[model samples]
Target: MTSTAKTPLPPAACATALDPTAEPFYLQVLQALDAAGVPYVVGGAFALAGLTGVERPTKDLDLFVRRADFDRLDAVLGDAGLRSELTFPHWLGKVYKGAFFIDFIFASANGLNPVDDGWFERAGRATILGHPVRTMSAEDMLWSKAFIMERERYDGADVAHVLRGCGAALDWHHLMDRAGPHWRVLLSHLVLFGYVYPDERDRIPAWVMHELLRKLHDEMLAPPPASGRIQGTLLSREQYLADLRHGAGDARLKPAGTMSAEEIAAWTAAIGEPHEK
Candidate 1:
């Protein structure tokens, strides 16, 4: 669908600005990514805000890139005067720029790789800070949040908000098809989040949380198991936390050289050039 397609907004999204300061910075980064020809689909809080029309102040920008292009991505960011803060050697993803705190996720270490290529292809277009950019599909955004919520990495309420707001706009069949095998996990998340009361959990409404839960139980779980393909391995949460602490002093985390006026101009000129064939 086109970017301008009328999609339902998330509930509890503020009509007024939530974080004016952070939004502008995010837009700049989006523009930088586009100019550098770096393909990305916006994720996390900013994406939640974009879909719901609610402004959620977030500290960093999250983007998804293919696994093969890490070095190319580093060069693109370098051209734009940003630098990697941490490269998870075991994980292909890296954290870039401390001040802005951008995280470039190559692929989920979890078994969510099926969504990767599709997300990049179907990314909806949007205007952030007056710059035209691509964003994750509302369905994909909800799935991402649902995945995180299931894993207990995020608050259940946040996932609920995203679901309630964007639920109406999602393509149920498409979501069910992609989320088919993970229905149990998704239902478990809904139960954990209190989106559905225990007795009433089986009845999914057209609403966001309910549909997601129902889709998980009804569609995803009904299918027979296929041969699963493992993606990259994931570090345990404890291991990841420890690595973050250990990498605290690494200067590689520091931002690369600041962009001079001339460099900024050149970088802007280079925006929209394709990064990969």
Candidate 2:
């Protein structure tokens, strides 16, 4: 039950939730990107609210771009009187105007799914702050959020809302392929989706459940691999620190994963201590 229909944009009233002073900067950033012809899709709270009709206040905006566009954005933002930094070399960068900023994401923190051409191919047309723009596809948004299971921030609920909201409109096949070698993570989220929305269980295609279950069965029967890979780290770097210290390889590290050792150390160091703002 996949679809190509564009999601309705969240109401302009939602913009009122942002800091009043920052609103102008937000609009300027959008206008700057359009003027510069830098292709990007609106994501983060904007996409979540668009797909699920659930609005939440957010200080930061998210724009998904290809890796190369991020490099170009460095100059684009600067020329527009804005500044930005590559917050995480592997996945994210932030554009700043005073204390308010927008995130330009090119990949996931775990280094699994990087933004690529396929993302734009599936993106939907939308308008925000009086500027025409693309919206992150439901499938791509779900793929990114599925891996965000940090102790401070778990997105399983967000994943379930997307499933409930998109229903048959979701491109299940594309999502499955996007999951690739990490299909189990997708399967687990699907299981939880059903648990969260009992009456809407049938929203998921029967064949998907059947296929994933069959794969799970095969996985269960297979012999454990000789290598000790702790996939929990892929879900949350901080939560799995104990495992790494106790002698287990992180699935997010090189030779076994997509990220580098230096990148992992830097990411771990950036984790802020849990506290009230």
The runs of at least 3 residues in candidate 2 whose Cα sits more than 4 Å from the true structure, single-residue gaps closed, are: 1-16, 273-277
State the displacement of the C-alpha of residue 220, model 1, in Å, after optimal TM-score superposition.
15
Per residue, candidate 1 scores C-alpha lDDT tens digits across 1-277 of 2222334443433222325556655665667667777777766665667666656556556677765666777776677776663344222354444444566765443324433578877787765566666777767766665544323245455555555566545576776676664655555555654444343332234354667655656665577544232111121222233344443221112132122334323433443444200
Model 1 lDDT on a 0 to 1 scale: 0.52
TM-score of every candidate: 0.59, 0.91
Clash count, predicted structure 2: 0
lDDT of each: 0.52, 0.82
lDDT of 2 by residue, 1-277 (tens): 6524344333333232466778789889888888888888888887777777777887777899888898788898898888899888888888887778888888988888989888889887776666677888889888899999987889999888888778678888888787787999999999998788776777788889999999999989999886888899999989989989999888998878889999999888888943111
Question: Model 2 misses residue 191 by how many Å?
Answer: 0.9
State each model's C-alpha RMSD to the native.
12.8, 3.9
